[model samples]
Target: MNKISESGVIGVDVHTIKSWIDQDDVVLVDVRETSEYDKEHIPGAMLLPMSKFDAEIFPKVLGKKVVLHCAVGKRSESAGKMLIDEGYLETVHMIGGIEAWKASGFATEVQITPPPSPSELKNQEPQFLCPTPGEVLRDEYMTPLSISNAELAGCIGVTEKDIEQLTQGESKVDVVLSLRLARYFSTAADFWVHLQIERDLEEARHEIGHTIREEISPRATASN
Candidate 1:
């Protein structure tokens, strides 16, 4: 309905977003948490929880505008800016979010699911970006199953000290460990590897993000 800035992201009414959705000209991303999303959400909006949002991981919205919306618009505005910062030429955020849409008599899809126990939620909830893979392993995977490092080591054919060191962040997740954990946890080995890589890259970014531009230059190609 109104332009908020010079950048591509702009505020639009629920009807405008609905029209874009109807025309299939926009990729709608709901930036609300999973709990809220599971209860009810815009019929076609893909859930990308703000708590775990990674701009780099925003879905492929090729040839279509990316529209973000939340419960009431604030999260969508922030998410829109995230797309802008990630070099999106233009982005749109629904001004009133699903709340406004519902107020306007728009239909929403609801997912039926059982609520998780509080302890389950505590164990499953991740620290945004999850500071370390070890923390993730200890808090999420291990504690939830009541598996001590010694037990996990025994089950996975690794030494107790190895598991201890890994959970302590004193060691890293290697191919062997990844495979072992994957087998024991019924997960992909790549999952552990990716977690380690994400942690390493996040630390690197924090350590040198600001200096990257000044320190590196694009290689020149030979003039034709």
Candidate 2:
């Protein structure tokens, strides 16, 4: 199949594009003015203003499959056509724009925040960061069901000393502890397992914070 084609384009509704936001492989570009974007746009969309389509924006997106959108369908259609002509592998325009998106029961919000930087993209991670230090302590020490440290330690066949040491950052996480904890708590087995495998909870906590602030916050915005 010809990778680059204008006539064979597919137009997706806003709701469909919204559902694809969490897919790591998809890239959604909004071909609207900065002002329009600030007022309201899809969460996680990267803006490549229609007025500024040039070598700078064109080259980076050349070989990738792109989904282009605007406030209505007009600008996105224009942008997609231009991108196909510029040798983009595939360019699909959003059919109904933001209004059609909202009409389908997908959420919308005015994005007061600026777009993420390239450096930000390079450092992105995942959720499980927003919990308080006390919560982290609880996750480590307290029983998952009862929220009592003593109870949890007993169920896991570990002394309170073990739980205390883990919570106090004194003991390095171990696979044995992780397995026992997973069975006892029935929470995120991989997270506990990862603590042992990676041998670094501080680093993991720090990374989780970045994800919470960047990627997770956008979803919160959409819901509001």
Q: Which candidate should be chosen as best, given lDDT against the real structure?
A: 1
TM-score of each model, paired residue for residue = 0.48, 0.42
Candidate 2 per-residue lDDT over residues 11-114, each given as its tens digit: 77665566566555467887766766777777777887655655235646443456887765555665565555567635677776665777787766674667
lDDT of each: 0.74, 0.58
Candidate 1's C-alpha runs over 4 A off are 5-8, 111-224
- Could you tally the backbone clashes for each prediction? 1, 0
The residue-level lDDT of candidate 1 at 48 comes to 80
Q: What would the per-residue lDDT of candidate 1 be over residues 1-224, giving only the tens digit for each residue?
A: 76664334688898887888899988888877776787788887888876667777677757887788876665566567667787765678887678789999999987776878999887774333323557657754677468998899899998999888888999998877877886876554454665677677766776687699789998999999
Model 2 gets an lDDT of: 0.58
Each candidate: RMSD: 16.2, 20.7
